[model samples]
Target: MDDDVERAARKVRDVEQAVSEHVTRGGPVTGRASSPDGAVTVVATPGGPPQSVEVSAAALRMGPHGLAAEIMRIADRAQRNANTRLHQTLERVVDPRELTAMGIERGTDDDESGWRR
Candidate 1:
């Protein structure tokens, strides 16, 4: 083979090797979130089993309704945290502007300036 073709083939092999190594060695990304009262905390990952939930004894003393609310809040917070991390990870791998230019707006706020949605 010509020098150019040989170099191209080597590059392709290197990329394949890199991808294999990455896939074999990487662990799922995870994030932890805690409630304002610190009574509840949850952990989650994008592509693997979720982390075990933890509730404080003080959280249990809050009564059933309040405890339920706390659980829901914790889940929300955990999912939000996981989503944020996943977005950051994917952003490194993909282009956000591509999604925007494709007219795919996700939880976008109308405020011109940046505002949390």
Candidate 2:
């Protein structure tokens, strides 16, 4: 029993190490989305940050509040997309269940409460 526990711990550690290394070597994961009017565009990366945002000249016509709302909406969608892609990519490197066991959320875009870390 003790040997089994030790082996399991070792395996978990190995998996964690591999995941870290793979992430370190992998390219940044990003997702992009634009407003319905094509006035706002956002490129977002996993962990909830916009890598870049682009606004068209037409966006200025929407007024300050309207443009800000559009940008926020687009950025949210882009972040969700990036998270989905990140989860999918991680699935290629590790079992989905393993990822969950390691505290990585594997929720879909529709799952608003998912993706906690």
Candidate 3:
């Protein structure tokens, strides 16, 4: 029992080390979004950068409705791009099992989680 625990601990430690080193391997991905009129801009860095932005009516050359739609489109694209990068980066160093051991679960409860190795 003690040996089993020790083995698990070691494995966890190794995974942690890999994650730490992996993150340092590259810079964060950054993205920019703008309103339809090119007036309002949103800057985002999903993995490392932000919860920061401002919106203003001054951005609306086509008026408020168009500006709002543009903002949504831009933000969604940025979010998807960030997610893609994050997923790829995570795949490089940590498997789902490692994430489960670290209490980082993904996917729906019905779907299950973790990797084989």
Candidate topping TM-score: 2
lDDT for 98 in candidate 3 is: 55
TM-score of each: 0.55, 0.65, 0.49
The Cα error of candidate 2 at residue 92, in Å, is 2.1
Candidate with the larger lDDT of 1 and 2: 2
What CA root-mean-square deviation does each model show from the true structure?
A: 9.4, 6.6, 9.3
Best by lDDT: 2
Candidate 2 lDDT (Cα, whole model)?
0.75
Give candidate 2 misplaced runs (Cα > 4 Å): 1-17, 20-26, 95-117
Instruction: Indicate whether candidate 2 or candidate 3 has the larger lDDT.
Output: 2
Cα lDDT tens digits for candidate 3, 60-107: 455778767776766655544454455556676777565445443342
**In model 2, where is the ten-residue run with the lowest total lDDT?**
108-117
Q: Indicate the worst ten consecutive residues by lDDT in candidate 1.
A: 108-117
How would you encode candidate 2's per-residue C-alpha lDDT over 21-69 as one tens digit per residue?
A: 7777776677777776679988887776798899999899999999899
Query: Which pairs clash in the backbone of model 1?
Result: none
lDDT of each: 0.58, 0.75, 0.55
lDDT of 1 by residue, 2-81 (tens): 99999999977875575455534554545566777779877765444457678998888989998888877766556555
Which residue ranges in model 3 land beyond 4 Å of their true spot? 1-17, 33-40, 47-58, 96-117
Ordered list by TM-score, greatest first: 2, 1, 3
